[model samples]
Target: MTQDGYYAVQLNSIEIPGEFDISFLTRTSNLKAGNIIFDSGTVMTMLDTDVVDELVRELTDFVSLPTEKPVAPHFKLCFAVRSTEQEEELPALWFGFNGQSGNLRVGPDKLFVWVSRFVKCLVITGTNDKVQVFGHITQQNFLVGHDLEKMELSIIEKDCTKLHEP
Candidate 1:
């Protein structure tokens, strides 16, 4: 959490590998200390322009789908999925954090938002400014806890959609 009491955490890096190889083409590991913010208020994650550009490059190379020009209100990276089957072909992404935070994997279903049955837009985007944000969509299915006294954040994986069940 920030000094103002917003639930936020720091990240060490965000990485996306090449389409056909494990070699990473885009890795934002050298971020300034405590620069990234895990924001619950935002719907989409945001990164610096250079980072976003590299991520776009890697994703474009990885996803073998027809490109669609970004339309209004969906101006990040958008693609045309021919069918439900095509949407399943998108590659996974990862977020790495400092210390024992480990790595968080984001699959295609979590990475893209379906605008239509045939159109899907990337949930990650670039910011004109230097603000790096970890948005809520990526936080789905996780129980996040903030310990103000200890100055620590705790994240536990769980099925958030099933929270109401006994």
Candidate 2:
């Protein structure tokens, strides 16, 4: 946990490549090697305002879906979809952490939310604050373990509904 009472991880890389083109985040070198606060109490992930602006531009161009005005005040990225089931059409985001062997891949379930019958909004928002927050909405279905002594964080995908089925 950080001194501010939030669990933090060394976020190094963010991947969202285009199969036929280069990565959408190729020019976002400024976002690398930053600490992101992992707070379970917050429902939406919040990145730096400038970072979010760049991401919004890339995602808007990458996703073929029609755009929608934000349903919520906190978010600027949204799309008009027939149903949440179309999540597969959205790109998946992978976040890499230092000291961790593998990247944490967040699918549509963790990246988006259904605001109305035909509206799906990105769960991540932009914040003017210096701290980048990784919220609970993006941590759903994952088992996150924090090792204070080693100063490391671990995340594993799990079916939380059946954690104690034994």
Instruction: Tell me the alpha-carbon RMSD of every candidate.
Output: 3.7, 3.7
lDDT of 1 by residue, 24-120 (tens): 2343434443556777888888877676677777778777897787765534788998877887877677776654456777777778887776788
lDDT of each residue in 31-60, candidate 2, tens digit only: 334457788988999877777777788789
- Model 1 off-target regions past 4 Å? 17-33
The whole-model lDDT of each prediction reads: 0.69, 0.75
Deviation of model 1 at 90, angstroms:
1.3
Q: Count the backbone clashes (under 3 Å) in each candidate.
A: 0, 0
Q: Which residue pairs overlap in candidate 1's backbone?
A: none
The candidate scoring highest on lDDT is 2
